[model samples]
Target: MLFEKPLTLEDIKKEPFIIEHIKWDAGPKELMEPSIVPSCDGFIKKEPLKGYIFYIDTMGDKPVLSLMRHTEAGFAETLAQLDDMPDELLKEAIDESKGKGCFGMYPINEKIKALLKKELGAG
Candidate 1:
């Protein structure tokens, strides 16, 4: 089933690792694995999904890394891209997160796309 609604940070925050039905082009829509750690062969760090991933588009006025994954500790460690990052770098992270080896990236809702594009000034 294709879920027309895209999940939000609030939704994720409410329930971590909650399976969400997302549109899949190859076949029927599939559920996205909460936090698939490729390095561990799709091993999830936490048993229950509590914290959700956050994509940092900008910090203050500057646009930092756009699609990098960040959890609770993960965010604190990275400090929300305090260091300048290249736009291309985010692609690699995104690919790795949504690759065949992993559960796949979370689907961004249409509203999210619009909001992000507006915030980022339209791609």
Candidate 2:
């Protein structure tokens, strides 16, 4: 379920399982790649941005599903939770995120989708 407050780095660090899942199972290899942007002269490679991460924030009274993206400074910014997103829009987000060469996008694979749904109580 969605939490009333956005997740913080401290909240994320408290959940080791979520971190390991993202590191070993859910996170795509492309997530580690730098983002490429078209520049005036050519293309510029920048630190990865806007790649989504799934985590369970246990800071509240109950476990809350959280979605976050990496910032330019390599910190995470919490976006929303499962209950906050409609199914159709979530599907579109996942579909559109694929095959984008990891450029300011998160590639949602089958494993990631399954985990997301399971954690969100949708699967």
Candidate 3:
């Protein structure tokens, strides 16, 4: 079932990814190479996956479904960093390319948006 829970900026500002597996106390992260990460150098509140959570092998024994959540600030940051372009420029591109199939941020942004939603929880 889909869940709609509001999150606070303060919470999200702390962690962008919400790894439900054993909470944060289970010592250092099992995955040496952290795949999912928090944005803004650690300033976001990730929420647990609401549906179809992916299984992480690194977290064993007490496996817990998890997801990451970030504030709109993070989204804007991602929008900038992902394309390596300024937000103003991107927005302009989006406006110019609108209605043209696969416009500016349609195809590519779709993927990034999916990833972001995935990181947060079920979309």
Candidate 4:
């Protein structure tokens, strides 16, 4: 389905299922350069990286897992609608993605697996 207006972070926050299942706190980040004239800061500095942000787009009849790229402004580009993936394929993808790092991969794959299981009635 098509949304009359673009979806926002507020829209994502309103979904109870997503809030309960998905890990919204973590995502890709980049290590910032250390200060040349630093004291004794042992902790590494990191900043949010530009990457895909997963959210449920409810414009459709059923809530669908949607992919969007976060921008300096906000969620901007709609990459894909991932609602129709076959159950087997989704399962395989989830399994294969386990224990993987965040670079060029879904950092929230477990959350996605949970959402998919709920959507596919597999739970």
Residues 64-107, model 1: lDDT tens digits = 43233323342312212322444445344344345332222333
Candidate 1 residues lying further than 4 Å off, grouped into runs, are 1-47, 55-85, 98-123
Candidate 4: deviation at residue 21, Å?
27
TM-score, model 1 to reference:
0.22
Best model per lDDT: 2
Give the per-residue lDDT of model 4 (tens digit) for 16-42: 443444334343322112223334774
| Local distance difference test scores for all models | 0.33, 0.50, 0.29, 0.46
TM-scores of all predicted structures: 0.22, 0.32, 0.18, 0.32
Instruction: Return the candidate ranking by lDDT, descending.
Output: 2, 4, 1, 3
Q: Name the better of 1 and 4 by lDDT.
A: 4
Candidate 3: tens digits of C-alpha lDDT, residues 1-123: 112443332333344343232122221122222335679887455442221111111132321222222232322111111222234543443344345322112212343334444544523
Q: Which residue pairs come into collision in candidate 2?
A: none
lDDT of 4: 0.46
Q: Over the stretch 1-123, how does candidate 2's per-residue lDDT look in tens digits?
A: 234676564554555544543422234344556578789999998755444565443344443445666555666666554454344544554565555423233444455456554553442
Candidate scoring better on lDDT of 3 and 4: 4
Lowest lDDT 10-residue stretch of candidate 1: 21-30
Model 4 TM-score, all chains together: 0.32
RMSD of each: 15.1, 12.7, 17.9, 13.0
Prediction 2 global C-alpha lDDT: 0.50
